[model samples]
Target: MIRRIAATLSALALTLCLGVALWLNDWIDETEIPPLVLETGVEVLDRDGALLRAYTVENGRWRLPVSYDAVDPSFIEMLVAYEDRRFWSHPGIDLRAFARAVWQRLTSGRIVSGGSTLTMQVARLLEDSGTGAWGGKIRQIRLALALERQMTKEEILTLYFHLAPYGGNIEGIRAASLTWFGVEPRRLTAAQSALLVAIPQAPNSRRPDRFAEAAEIARNRVLSRAVTFTDLTEQDVDWARNEPIPTERRDFPALAAHLSDRALADRPTQATHFLTIDVVLQARMEHLARRATTGLGPQISAAIMVMDHQTGEILASVGSPDYTDHPRTGFVDMTQAVRSPGSTLKPLIYGLAFDAGLIHPQTLVADRPISIAGYAPQNFDEVFRGEVTAAEALQASLNIPAVNLLSALGPHRMLSAMGRADMEVSLPMDEAPGLAIALGGLGTRMDDLMRLYGGLARGGIAPPMHWRAGEAPGDGQRILSPVAAWYVADILGDVTPPPNAPRIGLAFKTGTSYGHRDAWAFGFDGRHVVGIWMGRADGASVPGAFGADLSAPLLFEAFSRIGDRPTLRPGPPPGALTLLNADLPDPLRRFDPQGGSNGPPQPSITFPPEGAVLAYQPDLPVIARVAEGTPPFTWLWNGAPIAIGDRDREVILGDIGLGFGELTVIDATGQAGTRQIEIAD
Candidate 1:
């Protein structure tokens, strides 16, 4: 009779819970889960929906997808063992456990125990619980009925995985995996799985790290059940129980935040939208960036990007080295920093000038020192070259010539181009009055600079920069005439120094900002163009850190090691214009710096000068000159040796580097009178 009464009470409690759950379900509005907000405004993903990172939102509530592959099998085993052992046997609530629970409660003469099963737990979670005991019981019973009627055993477990709270604010396995283990649910190992399963019981109050020892106890329970019910072997349980779990992969939480701030510009939530990043290429880019940044001190940083010139897709982007694990790194993202682009902006001005029909590849310009009223434009050496074709001037990286071209174009044209390129600089329009535009006198960002050059690379059409895949791109304004674009490309291709490694064929340019505050190098082969701008985001100056010295090495190294990419025929320019080498009889090298290469003929000195010092005159430093000879050779000196084009020490006065050295001649016909010497005062 007592047992019958206990059974009756349990049945009555189950019936009450079931009715409440039905009432709540019918009363409540909806149950479908909402998505996590994209506070950063731009979403970065691999080509597929796999997430790379995200930014903070006002609510700080972001939800990632709960994939079917997400739950750890061990987690399932543990939940079944501890939450409801007879979960498969029961329709929803366990009638036997409920009866026993009622008898215990009655014997204790108070509410000492309350029986609950996974299905009832699911019900309470589906909606808010009422305050009174009767109300709570009704709610639980109603939810159990809902679960039993609406879901299969498999479906119940899946929903529970999604709705079950694991830790503070982490609603599902996917979120919990990222927060604690730094990996996706699919990536967690058995040990990690065990620890996660133990967390939901007392989430916020429990510290997985602090109670790692206690987590082991629960881990064993899951392992034992898994062995008996599943095909898992005893050895597997032993390993999980005894072997320490290797740490889960960590993420650069700070980087995500930083990328969030920058990538989340006008449209704050845009960062979470599907981005145009190619996961594979982004991986490749990250590897290359990390390798390059190795050994750089903590204060140092780097940003690199791989851009598809035609499509404007950012294939791979690494703003900082892999910091997914190091706790100390809660800082900067290299990708979106607003730093000076140094010479990376060179191509923009040059391309623009060419597009405007103001310049051509074969156009002759003087690479000589000239003083602009307020600013004196000089080459790197503060020297000058007499004249050179536009291609030669750019290839040699002559500063003066660029300033001259800028001067010729004037600042209005430059400002116009800058506007078209989307540069947000506060230029007075009067400051950049000359050819110095070729040297990137104005500051620019890595993103805009890359886009500007990409325009030139992709037939002079400005391809919009995007972080998401979309239906179709709107037309971009034509920034360059097809002929103008080809002219610059052809020039860059012809003038580029041979690649350090024959394996790499690149068409690129290098640039350095004034005072060496930034170093920039960018180039493209066929399919892709990469622009790298490196410097302290704080705008620190690193002397001698010119484009060739810093950014170029990385650019070259990447292309050299990246293996073969298919060649793209830039195709013929519009109007049937084609590339043809024009000898351009114009003078390209400067004739003077006093002792410059273009200096008129000088005298010769001799072996007497080996140790003997002649009276030194301050003005006319002793100069050795030679008569023009056959076959070219180098010359050395007592006064100052000159390279007499052929095998003689003819005074090409500026040939100072060959000072006090031997003259090597290739052709015969030696003439003693060929050499002349200007004795020291």
Candidate 2:
């Protein structure tokens, strides 16, 4: 009777256990598990994927997402060994570890060790549940099982890496590494790895920056257990124990502050932004800008930009000397600020003249004081460099010569060229373009000037610059002919460097705006171009502060920091001519604004009226006639000179091509007339 009763009770107990198991499975299935998608802060990276800046996430938390692969191998080993030795083999909960914990707790009458695997910790973090109660533990077990069913081991670990708390408002290994040690988590010393492993266990109490003693104790405990649990030697543990813990948190990287802010503002929903900036170079240049601006004045600020002319990539852009200087209005990005460009535009003016066959580099130009239409431009020093070569005039930055050249080239034409080069020029509110623009009458940004100079360096093709990595640059526009660009480069290369600056073969120019309000320096080699600006942010004059004295030295120092020798200037192009004033052709030898006609009628094309179309005849030649100006005249088909020093008022165009063309007549004086016509076959 007793054996039969025991058998019945055993059968009943088995049926009850089976029923409980089925109910538990149903309960686990019904439990809600949140999605594993973690939200992280926005990060700004440089060209090499180095962090330039980072913004806090919602609730102002510094939680940067890190993958399992980004974590150091040693750190992972230490973490797995210390947290869950059976992490890989266990389903979700380790029954052996649980039994050991229960036995120890029962014997000691208190908690000895908690049997929570890395997955259980990740589950707790995801649900923000606590482990102080049996209910929370059961919830974590269910969630852990569910998570394991859905995610791989690597994915679970990556989740832990992204969600693990380290200290106040800082989560994830990446945030911890950067905060405590100022580096990424890809490479960490044993001590740093141990410390990082320990912090997440009791993040608030073991914060290295707050509770150093607790942090050290926890870190050393992990190191002590590492001997048996990991491959660490006693010697390694000793060394790791002896290493000092960080006492304070470090501020995140804040290089390229203005640009980073702009990027974030431009794309608010983006989680990461990659720029074309080189962080190392950007850091060096920012420091240089700050150092250069020191002691200049309380309100003076500086801006700089460096670009690869060939690729039109902006390597570095320093918006201001200091981003926090309230007195200097440092928040303003001067690179984008519209300011007078001073005499920097002179090079372009001279280049246009060269392309027009008006003057060579060695051609003599008069720089005496002259007034035209009541607009008179004076040199910076109010001194004239009379009868100087065009090259000399440009090198010395004489205002009279540049104004004279611009007058001949026409301010409208100069503006058109700038437009073609993709530069945005701001003429003072609703004012017409004038000769004064040649001498800083117009306002332009530093970046636009960089494009202009970079174009000159790139053989006259101005490529649109881009700041974002992987962005395709726009098509380049022809600003000057290759020969004209070469001539300008050759002339600027001969400019004397500032004191103690070695000639690094850089072609550079300096300009001081009227009233000394702005100082500008722009330079280029065969490969790179850099531009600098220094002045009070409020546009107030700094008396006696000139570009030559202030900005040029900084420009040269920037090149030195770049650690690249200036590339050799290219050879002259096909039509380029290197000659002295005496050797140049008569009309090209001296710039005569009057065209040497002495008050005669302005030259005009009579036969080919403006916008006229003529039929093409194979055997018949087109007849071209010029109105009165001078007996000897130069006729041009399109821009190239076709008939030079012709004594007659009419010239035969036997060799002219049948197509749309421009007819131009130039008198002995600098006066010219042009007609656009097309010949059809």
Candidate 3:
């Protein structure tokens, strides 16, 4: 009787356990989560859309966004080796293997040796993206069994291939392929495959820079797998080493970290994201920024942005001028750092006034040094042109005119305009002085400033700044008037550097921050608005260092590489160029209807085409119009004997000013065009 009773109780207990297990399984299967999405990358592109990057979830890790097939197989292999050794053989759950892992853990002091097969891992990745303890692990085991029953081995592997985490905020082999290998997973070679496969072991800890040995070891292990699976030897590996190692692997941590910070800003991984970036454009920007800062000094960082002016699509962002290729160095993002913008803000200030109808492109303002309640503003050089046109003030990057223009337009309005441009900086209406506003005293993100300039380039509509994946949650608002935008764009074009530059049909502005701590050059050509910001990480000053000297060349390199030329879309500006009431001061007072001072507000004899070439005699003055928001500029050639009076109008090749070499004008933030002149004196 006792034996029979015990047997019945055992059967009952078993039935109850089975019931509970089934119930939990049903619960887990039914548990639905809105897909893991990145808020910034919530924007979905069309088929073959030109998005420059992708963020995929792979095997339970968060990684960078990459191209669909961007990861190397090595990256994939790393997941297989570390997560599931019998990935090729196991159906999903290996009961015997799971038993062994349990025994090993019981005997050992570690929670190591998970016998989860590739199928189980894929299941875990799908169901468990947590950093918690036993709860996630128990769920993982149950899900693995369910997944094995639900999906074929091939299907599970396929899913695993797409969703494994390789690094920070980056998931899936696709993103790993792009972020680490800078290639597609489909195109991965055995060596490249090994590199990709190795990264996930400890994405952050086994950084290429910090743990080169470990990463290489992990790579070699994947290589060994591919080799052993076939008929290759260490000798083959020896032969392969002669081939090029991946340059991308060397830069992974930096790129991944940069994207991580950018991604976290918009939304958590659960929200939708749309990035205003094209993959090719983003890659191109990084390559160019790296090239530009190749020989620049140590501790110098730069932030670069390429935006579609109208769409506010940030096609590419390179936050670091060039990372030291060191893992720790990856911690600092040059693009996000707040630095003085100096003259880069000049164009925007002018744009603020132009947009408000408070100032005209032909507005005349005294360029001479001016004292504003003990805030004496001066030009980049100590001396200044007494009375100058707005255009000259911009081209010369004069401080006083910008301050004067800001003063005319209320400080509150100027800040408001910046806000409208998607700049995320605050100026307590009182602390943010109008007089020194042109000098770029406000602290702001480099990316923000780029978008602000993008507003001008896009013809007055300031599209909301976008990063990661999706379009702005809502359509953006127009910040500047269309006419105001056009006027600014036009003036920017007029003052653009000469025809000799490799880049053409581009509008740009350059700036220097206080104490020369930062140098910046940014602006838009027809298609892309690129902004570059350079500064010392420690906030050290660079004496005599200004944006024009340091940052313009970097802009040229990028523009030269970006093949497409953008043309201004047609639209009427605020005022006609009849030159009816344009105020021309002395030196410029003798305004040439075809030259400087005589160009704007005048329906003149001729308007040069967007990409025209000009030659000059040493003593002749040159003048042209750019976008209205752009400040007027002057050229002071020291040895060529060119002297542009403060009020001097027109670009001339002549004598050098008192303390400088051949001077060039950079409008907004972009490369300076080259103009050659035969000095007459």
CA lDDT scores, all candidates in order:
0.57, 0.87, 0.57
Per-candidate TM equals: 0.67, 0.92, 0.57
Best by TM-score: 2
Q: What is the lDDT of residue 169 in candidate 1?
A: 51
Select the stronger candidate by TM-score from 1 and 2: 2
lDDT score for candidate 2 against the true structure: 0.87
Taking the tens digit of each residue's C-alpha lDDT, what string does model 3 give over 1-681?
999999999999999999998897786577443243322233233113433323334343334334324444444554465456676666456777788888988889666666667665565666655533577666666666566656566566666665565656666665556556555466766665666666755667555545666767766766666565544467876665444444344223223236544564645554333444555656677777666666666556666777666556666677675445552253477777767777777777776555433345665667665565687776667887776666666777778777766764557767777776667774546664555666777778788787777777766656666664454545554566555666666666666563345546567788888889988888676667788777666678878677777777777666665656564444554332324233421222221211223333411112223334444344554453223313333222211113323222334333232221122332221112222223222
* lDDT by residue (tens digit), candidate 2, 1-681: 999999999999999999999987787778788988989989999999999988888899999868788999999999999999999999778889888988999999998998888999999999999987989998899999888887899999999999999989999999999999999999999999999999998999999878999999999999998899988999999999999999999999988888888989999889899999999999999999999988877799999999988788889999998888999999998998999999899999998887766777988889898888898778888887679989999999998988888887789989988998888988777788989999989988899999899889988889668889988477788887777889999999999999999888999999999899999999998788999999998999999989999999999999888866556878887556777778765666788764533577777788878899999987878889988776578776644567778889888877677776557676776566777689988
Candidate 2 Cα deviation (angstroms), residue 416:
1.3
Residue ranges of candidate 3 with Cα displaced over 4 Å: 1-150, 156-183, 187-256, 265-274, 323-330, 352-359, 428-434, 496-500, 567-575, 578-681
Model number with the top lDDT: 2
lDDT by residue (tens digit), candidate 1, 1-681: 999999999999999999987776674423332232211213455557666665433355334545345666656765676668899888777888888878987788776444778777666655645423867876677567556766688777766666666554556566667777777777666666766766665555444555655556655666677777665688877887886632333442332234334455645534354556665556666677667656655444556667777777766666665545243142555555555555555555565445433344665656666776677766776667787766777777777656655554456666676666555654436664344445665545676767677777777777666555673355555565565666667667764453464434567787777777767777777767777656655667766667776777787665554445754538655332242224321111221122212433323244334334444545444454334433343342221123333444443334223222222221122111222123333
Model 3: lDDT to the true structure: 0.57
RMSD of 2: 3.2
By TM-score: ranked, best first: 2, 1, 3
RMSD of each: 17.3, 3.2, 15.3
